[model samples]
Target: MSALKLAIVGGASTYTPELIDGFARLRDTLPIGELVLIDPAADRLELIAALARRIFARQGHHATVTTTTDTTTGVHDADAVLLQLRVGGQAARDKDETWPLECGCVGQETTGAGGLAKALRTVPVVLDIAERVRAANPHAWIVDFTNPVGIVTRALQSAGHKAVGLCNVAIGFQRKFATHLGVDPELVRLDHVGLNHLTWERGVTLLDTPDATTGTEVLPRLLTEHGQAIAADLHLPLPVIQRLGVVPSYYLRYFYQHDQVVKELQDKGSRAAEVAAIEKQLLELYADPALDTKPELLGQRGGAFYSEAAVQLIASLLGTDHRTTVQVVNTRNDGILPFLPDDAVIEVPATVDATGVRPLPQRPLEPLYAGLIASVTAYEHLALDAALHGGRDRVFDALLAHPLIGQIDLADHLTDRLLAHNRHHLNWA
Candidate 1:
């Protein structure tokens, strides 16, 4: 077998150490022969590279680690490229996460108006990098570890690039469920469905495990056994879980209790500001020269289990693993959920192997869930149009279509603010 060459775009992120730790620890899963860290931020890259080398050395791994500013050069011979880039950096994120609160909407990186702004700024940049990667190495699989994953992954697939989107949300749930059930995580399978960030864990099945005494429909047992704990994790009332018989991803709180979330966001301030401070401290620690391993503070920066999720995805996709694995990923719906359009991207359990990602069959959702999915899918359609084509009207239309920004007046407010805050990114605007 050929040695695995992995190139990480945006390798300068403070989160890079988390991934590096995984690479060193899970060397058996992915024998990375040559690892390339690609970034334009030269100073950040320097600090990250030094730390990556130290981590590898400490772990006694011999992966040839390298760094570069040129995307084409860094990805030339790589078999897989992971994208975790932010187009305008945290300054843009701070703007995205704060401006929506001005309209009394929940400000977040991957939902509603802020997410639309991020998509408009990010999709184009990601596509450009994918094109460059294709030019250099046609066979390289692009794994997107970026936010607004559903939209970005759809754009890549629609353009015919070989890419899949990764998020740790599903894996985090799996681990939590496994811990609660006292079983190995691999034994637990999630009937995870919906569009990226907007998803629910409707079913939990344990595969031929001795501890799976409750059988495939263990969702109710989970609710009955740990409803309060699960509800607490999602910041939802226990009755909601008992009523719905489904565990909503934490992102659902924005839709389920929009007003509450908006008020909470207003009071707590922007998550971006918190993460910016964390990143600053992390960079200081990275430059410490004495420090090597990933620090605890990195967990507070979000994206828990990100490296494990990415590694499993890459290992499964590259044919390194013998067994086909079911992992949650963002890919085209293709009727996976009957209610959504074929082109709309959704996050769901997918079977991975050398062939490609195939979303497993999803049970029909209740009208309540299906209606929301349909409405959001429509908004995503408009969102992608605006992200790709660019215009004020398109932006307004997308926001107007969103459930969270349904009012025309609010949509208009957000559109102007989005265009104003992101004019440098949206050239046509």
Candidate 2:
């Protein structure tokens, strides 16, 4: 097989170097002949591309790195396209993290009312980009890393694009569990299930080997021995995990502790502000000619372990290693969960290889978790509807359906605020 040509749609992002480092370190897994960074921000794009070249050189990898503002040119003949673009950038994210708090909702980028705003702004743009990728290379896979992943990915698949959504949550948990178990990270497999941000670790298994298909279930042991540490990592009470017999995603804090999270968010500055400051520092660091590795500061910038996750998924999708691996990915449900529609995009452990992703069979979901998953799944359907077709009522209905803002009056207030802040991006508004 020939070397792969991969394109990153939002390659100018501060997160690019992390990916560059992964590609450099994992060269044997996913060999690339060329990497095209596509972004409208020309200045940042150049800075990131220069650093990417330096990182590759430092690792003695010879893949050519290129930058372009033209989407069609960048993605032309690519084997896979990765979407990481933020629609309105940090300023819009700041709004997404703050405005919802005014109405007593948890202010977050990928949950509740604010998530709906992001979905409204992002879905249309991603679809347009997917079209370009499809036109350029009909067989190229589209890997979505955008916010509100569940809704955005659903839209892509619903439109019949070869798309799959990915998140760092599962990998992050796997790494943490490996540290606790004193085992190789690759040997740990999680029974990770649910929607994008909303997911749980139903079982933690230690594979006999890295590529083994069966493993010993160790979730009960982990909970018994290191439950407190795990709970601390999630910032949830240890009793909660013990009671449910599953570990919830940290994002579930927004739902499990709604009022308290709202209060905390109200008291603190937006995460976007912190990221903006970090980006400024990272850009300055990137400007240094002597720097050849991703800075320590970038780790604090978030998206931890994103590069590894992207590399593994891309390699598996391209069949570079010719091994079918079960990874937690966001893909079509197809009866993985009896409760959701087949078209609904779900985050669960799935078999991934060159052919495509297929959701693996899962143990039945308990009502406690299933109810919230079903509720959010319905909200996601509505969110996609509002994103595809634009209207105030559509936005209102999506927000209303969200478990975080089911109250009519609260949805009313959030709808007006959302449209007000996003009118510039929303053509219909």
Candidate 3:
């Protein structure tokens, strides 16, 4: 069998080592022959190249290492491409975070108005990369790790490429809950279904175990029977969990911001400081040697949280495993939300094997939640149309779908901003 060739794009310095180690561990099953590293930053790419080479050398893996600032060269002939690109870094992220907050809207980088802004900035880049990937290696599977994943994945799918957006938040919560419950992660199966950055842990099950029970049945019992002691026993950071609270998988803070999560996002909260420090360090890491050595974490429990969901997809494609877990993947909506634009990009349960990914049909979301996702999907469509069609009306449509911007002012605001900020890119007739 020919060796698998993997391409890593963007923040290659931070994400490459973990992927190198991930593939290294899979040598027995899926041996890699090449690691193609792509990043616009030459120095960061060089350091990553050195680390990958050293790691492979130490592990005695003969994975050939290649580095490039050029996308075409790096992605050419690749079997699987893992992309983690960010447009403008923290400064851009800060804008995404602060701008919406200023608008009295939910200040999130991955959803709503902020997400629309990010999609506007990032969709063009993603499409260009997808085009290159298609031209270079039409057979390659693009595993996108970019934010606004739902929107980006939709764009790639629209452009007609095999692609899936990957995120770690849901998986991290599953692992954390499993650990607290003293269950093996692989044994503790969960049903995490929703869009990117917003998900609910629908259920958790112990697969094929003799004493298996439904999460709904088991969880309430666990919480009632042993809430306080369980918190003490597990030493969990979520003290609220000691009081029978079910932690919704992603953006727990936003949902509980008025209560339990208020502290987590506050200045005194560990999470807020953690995010701040990491952002600061990332800004200076390129110039300073000290931050380069600082470990990079992709999930809640450090590197473990960022395990390649792509590997599961690859394994499924090869049919090497009987079962695998993946989160936030999109497929045809066969009823997860009956009214939410049946074609909307929804995160949900997927079963994969040699045949392909089969998104499990799920119960329809309640009217309110379904409507929220529908509204967001509307903006998603308009954003893509604006990017591909480059019309002023499409930009207005994108803003119109947003709840924060009413139809009355949508065109005016979009026009003023489009003229002022996106003048060169906007198409006016």
Candidate that scores best on lDDT: 2
Tens digits of per-residue lDDT for model 1 on 1-429? 667999999999999999999999998888898899999999999999999999999999899889999998999978999999998999999999999999888899899999999999999999999999899888889999888998899899999999999999999999999998988888888889888888899899986763343456688889999999999988999998899889999999999999999999898988889999999999999998888799899999888888888888999899887558788999888988877889889999888888889998887788888899899999988998998998888999999999998998999999988998999888797
- Give lDDT: candidate 2, residue 321: 77
- Best-performing candidate as measured by TM-score: 2
Clashes of each: 0, 0, 0
Question: How many Å off is the CA of 378 in candidate 2?
Answer: 0.4
Evaluated at residue 53, the lDDT of candidate 3 is 74
Task: Locate the minimum summed-lDDT window of 10 residues in model 2.
Answer: 260-269
Off by over 4 Å in 2: none
TM-score of each: 0.97, 0.99, 0.79
lDDT tens readout by residue for model 2, 1-429: 788999999999999899899999999999998999999999999999999999999999999999999999999999999999998999999999999999989889998988999999999999999999999999999999998999999999999999999999999999999999999999999999999999999999999899898899999999999999999989899998899989999999999999988888889879999999999999999999999999999999888998899999999999997999888899999988999999999999898999899889998998988999999999999999999999999999999999998999999999999999999999888
Q: What is the per-residue lDDT of model 3 for residues 1-429, given as tens digits with 9 covering 90 to 100?
A: 577787888845455566676666666556678888999988778877776676677678898988999999999898778878877654565655554443334445666555666676778888899899999988778877787888888788777788877777655656666776677765566666666666656556654552343334345655666556545533444466644244354453453442333333233333323555664454454344333232453332233545455566665555454444343465545566676665566777676555555677676565645555666667777877776766666767776776556464644554454334434333342
- Model 2 residue 291 CA deviation (Å) reads 0.6
Candidate ranking under lDDT, highest first, comes to 2, 1, 3
lDDT of each: 0.90, 0.94, 0.63
How much lDDT does candidate 1 score? 0.90
lDDT of 3: 0.63
lDDT of 2 at 145: 93
The full ranking of all candidates by TM-score, starting with the best, is 2, 1, 3
- TM-score, prediction 2: 0.99
